[model samples]
Target: SFRRSNVSPRFLHSNSTSHTWPFGAIAMLIDNAYDPDVSAKQFWIDKTVVKDQDCLTFMDNGYGLDLRTMHKMLSFGFSDKTTVKGVQPIGIYGNGFKSGSMRLGKDAIVFSKSKSTSCVGMLSQTYLEKIGAEQIIVPIVCFDQTKSDKHILDLMQ
Candidate 1:
């Protein structure tokens, strides 16, 4: 279910931490999609007809996360916005991506495409549990040509 990639980061979990909330995951999706560069576009939430799929999707025409930004998103306490001297962005603490995604499902599939490139990344709590790891591993892949088939999409770029 994950693409072959050389880059994967593991975030350690501690026994004393309680890191999930019922609404925080959904909130993260909305908050990240806010403030698009383009105007006259709206965000949406909908259910898909795919069988056995109970997940809800939040989508918008907002600027999507690039590979670099996506990597930072999965990392604990890593926010590029914090480095900007005069810029004040909301929730610069950077715990939202990991905690929120983990809370939402046993795994998360993040897909984002920029003008020249498209990327896919997956974070699986089940894999972490099976390995008895305190860390979360995110597998990422980037490509120029898009594949129509899901299985072929897992091939290395």
Candidate 2:
């Protein structure tokens, strides 16, 4: 029903290349964490600096993500909240997830869990450049009650 447009790899790379880290990206992430629809309550931001590693972590007690939400979150220029009738969304372009993670580092792993589902996905700029991938395939596994507990534990490990 919809026709796909031709987008060159160079264009994709250049378009995403940001010389400076944008604070809006961070704000977008926090805004999404607090969005009413997300049902997030407790939120946390953690930063650590060690000898070999310096990292930041953001966590929230949201409803977590389903497949569709995760896909839209990562897609360039795609956002469902922008069309909402009454509410105003903080982000319009849906660049928050991608751009924010990129600003943090070259690699990020997103993990989400709900009553019925739990999934893990990784984004790595180095990997993308090496593979010349136009799109990111976030491998997802739907788990049963027994596996869900174990899977979440393993992911944490």
Candidate 3:
């Protein structure tokens, strides 16, 4: 069984306001990738035009997140990270992804691929508002290469 709670979409913008400086928000995201659990040695940030809209992309060769982890990342107030190999993680509040991402834009799409799975998740204030949603909603899909589910395949494409 799954339990549900209601969080207004407007919270995204209000929460992001804590980031007075955009650079600080970007640093929070970079710290997440550099954290011990992800241990990313390389990270790339770029800006490109998509459908005539300027967009930013961040990529890292880190240990990618699974569905469960992705869910936790999108949710508020959940952090299970601990010290690893004498290295400490910088994101302790578990609010970085939301605050940082929403500070940069109204929408964000995350693509992560672990050793055996690929996942996609989206956090979008624009989407919520357009749909007249009262509560925040995040849609996530995971694809396991070993399985051949048509629905999953469609989502992957």
Candidate 4:
């Protein structure tokens, strides 16, 4: 956790956050977050999925790449609010933005069109690497919501 007062140089040495890892390390993090045993992709695809009309537009360009730039975006309404109903705080790690950076690639362009006008979380691995960070991001772009069920079983892996 970076304190508001002291930045980097000092923050790097702090105990709260001290683990400078390479880009390859991110792959393991993502795999650990999600499971390979009991899969849930099919359930999510069949249940929560409605139509392709649920993606909200977003510039997955890492939501901009710097602290000032990202903060500016949030201040300008890039981090929209929406409903979050997952498990009862079980596997929920409470930080999707960070997770997205690794899975989406260092420089990804994400575009979503969802049902809600205010539901978004954009992350860029390229920018995160510059700042020394990463996450298990999964920005799923629905391809014809109608193609759920067995179609997704093959896509889950």
Query: Could you tell me the TM-score of candidate 2?
Result: 0.69
Model 3 residue runs over 4 Å out of place are: 1-5, 148-157
lDDT of 4 by residue, 98-133 (tens): 333333233433333323211223444444455654
Name every residue pair that clashes in candidate 2. Answer: none
* TM-scores of all candidate predictions against the true structure: 0.65, 0.69, 0.90, 0.25
lDDT of model 2, residue 125 = 66
Error of 2 at 32 (Å): 0.9
The stretch of ten residues in a row with the least summed lDDT in candidate 1 is: 7-16
Q: lDDT of each model, Cα atoms only?
A: 0.58, 0.63, 0.88, 0.30
lDDT of 3 by residue, 4-80 (tens): 76789999999999999999889988998999989999999999988888899999999998888888888898888
Which structure among the candidates has the greatest lDDT? 3
**Order of the predicted models by TM-score, top scorer first:** 3, 2, 1, 4
Give residue 53's error in model 2 in angstroms.
3.7
RMSD of 3: 3.4
lDDT of candidate 2 over 52-100, digit per residue (tens): 7677778899878766666566567777665345556676666767767
- Pick by TM-score: which candidate is best? 3
lDDT for model 2: 0.63
Candidate 2 residue runs with Cα over 4 Å from true position: 1-3, 6-22, 48-51, 82-87, 144-157
